[model samples]
Target: MRTVEEHQAVVTGLLAPLPVEDVPLAAAAGRVVATDLPALVSLPGFANSAMDGYAARHAEVGTASEAAPVRLPVGADIPAGRTDVPPLLPGTVHRIMTGAPLPEGADVVVPVERTDGATDVVTITGAPDVGTHLRHAGEDIRAGDLALPAGTALGAAQLGLAAAVGYASVPVRRRPRVLVLSTGSELVEPGRPLQPGQIYESNSVLLAAAVADAGGDARTLHFVPDDVDQFLTTVRAELAGADLLVTSGGVSAGAYEVVKDAFRGLGTVEFAKVAMQPGGPQGAGTVDGVPVVTLPGNPVSSFVSFEVFVRPALRRALGHTSPDRLRTTARLTTALRSPAGRRQFLRGRFDGEVVTQVGGPGSHLVAHLARANCLVVVPEDVTELPAGAEVVVVLIEGALQ
Candidate 1:
């Protein structure tokens, strides 16, 4: 059996990133930028006030103090968003509001509170330093400077910056569309009574959420029946323009593994019982030229498969620079054991740098997987871990516990 790393590479190699397209700034959030952005105009595009104050000349207010106040007429009042305003009159101050463009010939703005305002005759009891509270044009960003770089993951701040640079829309990679499938004869949908030897097929919903979390636009298709011909027909018929296909169950070692049976003769497949517990027997191949990632039948296995393999592929397709999940080494709060030959991924909750096992390592434990925020990683060589032992963990959802 191949190691987890080998199988991961095989899946990633088969799934390539999609092309880029133009999207509005609001819609660009969470999407990767496809083009470099240049500042159409300077950041402070014009000389504006950084604070609500009086714009004045340093020379006029040089000796303004409590004992000898320099009284000047309020020549012009500039409010925020005022683009065109006359320059300040000689020997006078400009009453400027915060974010307002500074009137010409005004070197500094003394906050209104700092001055004694009485009618038009304002006494500047405090002398502001040279250029105090003045925001110079292009100081924050120069015209023609690199505004936003390519491959940037657009967020609220990036969206604001892009709009400030006159880009109503940005070039961003389109989010890949994914179709998720779940297979098995012993599986039933939620809200139904479970018969003997039957359970709800939950990994479809869970994996779909994971795909959405990984930045892919995902949809869960109807469960594929366990019959080989039925499964193949449903897969072929429902596989529209999906950039990727994710399947759970029917790929394991059970006798009636319909997914494996249906795709057995089809070429372009890599079957690997990887060296990882909770998610070991898996497959990755192309069906009808669309990339398909087959995860193990178990719930924890499906979640781990998405984290270890599918997430990177989805991120890459969306043009993200860092396409893999983050790995953190943490101290285990409790002891655990792993299979002698397989690398174990224990469901865990991480607080700060400490990872406490959420439960023991079992592939079919869905409730434990649901409560876990992280996966404690155990190397294939080591079989046991004592309490407080350090282990590497992969964060899948939510903040560290």
Candidate 2:
């Protein structure tokens, strides 16, 4: 059986970065930048007032005080967006609003509260230092400067930065398109009448949702019956635009294993048993030049396999910097035994400090899996763990506890 690390390495080695495309800024959120973006214009663009005040030379009000005020003529009203106002008159004040362009030769802004707001003449009761309350052009960012570097994951702040720098659209790495398929003869869709000995099909939905949560565009194809020819034909027909293909079921060593029988000698596909609990039988390779990954049919096993191998591959293809699930250390709240020689991933509820198993080590326990927020990882060397033993926990959903 192949070790977990060896199988993960194989899956990573088969993938290549997806192509980049230009998308509007509104759609760039959660996408990775493909190239460095430079600022098109300087921030603030022009010298403006940071407050609503009178613009004047600070020297003119040098000795003005509450007891002895200095009065000067109000030259003009410089409201915001007034582009035709004349320069400041010497020894006079200009009534300026916030964000309005500072009149020429004005070195300071005395707030209206300090000066009597008069149209004919204003009284200044205080002095301000030169260059006060002035927002200079390019003070925040200069023209042609790098706004955002390549490989930046665009979130709210990053998208705002792109738009502030005048980018209507940006070049971003396209999300990987994943096609999920399930192959089994004893399976029927939910809400459909099931025959005796048949079960509801769920692996395709589970794997597709996992793919989407890991930043891939996922779509599930109809379930393929346990026939080699039909399986191959369906996979081939849907291989045209898929960046990656994932199939659940029909890879184990069974007489009617459609996936194994159909792709036995095709492309570079290889099937092997992995040294892990729940999900052991795995397959990875290419079909018609598109990367294909196969997982076990059980819903829990399929989800665990995607979390271990396929999630990282899809995230990497989408240009994400961190592709692995977030892991935390927690103490076990109850004793548990794992199969010797196999690494175990048991579903559990993690409460920040202690992890309690939700169910037994069965791959078909979907209800217990639903109540789990983490996967408690047990190394192959350890067969049994005490209640207080420290275990590595992979946060799958809910809070990071």
Looking at candidate 2, the ten consecutive residues that score lowest on lDDT are: 392-401
Best by TM-score: 1
Kindly list the per-residue Cα lDDT of model 1 for residues 213-330, writing each as its tens digit: 8888888986668888878888888787988888888887769988888887687666778888878888999998989898887788888888888998788777788887788889
Candidate 1 local lDDT, residue 255 = 91
After aligning candidate 1 to the native by TM-score, how far in Å is the CA of 382 from where it should be?
A: 2.5
RMSD of candidate 1 to the true fold? 1.7
- Candidate 2's C-alpha lDDT? 0.88
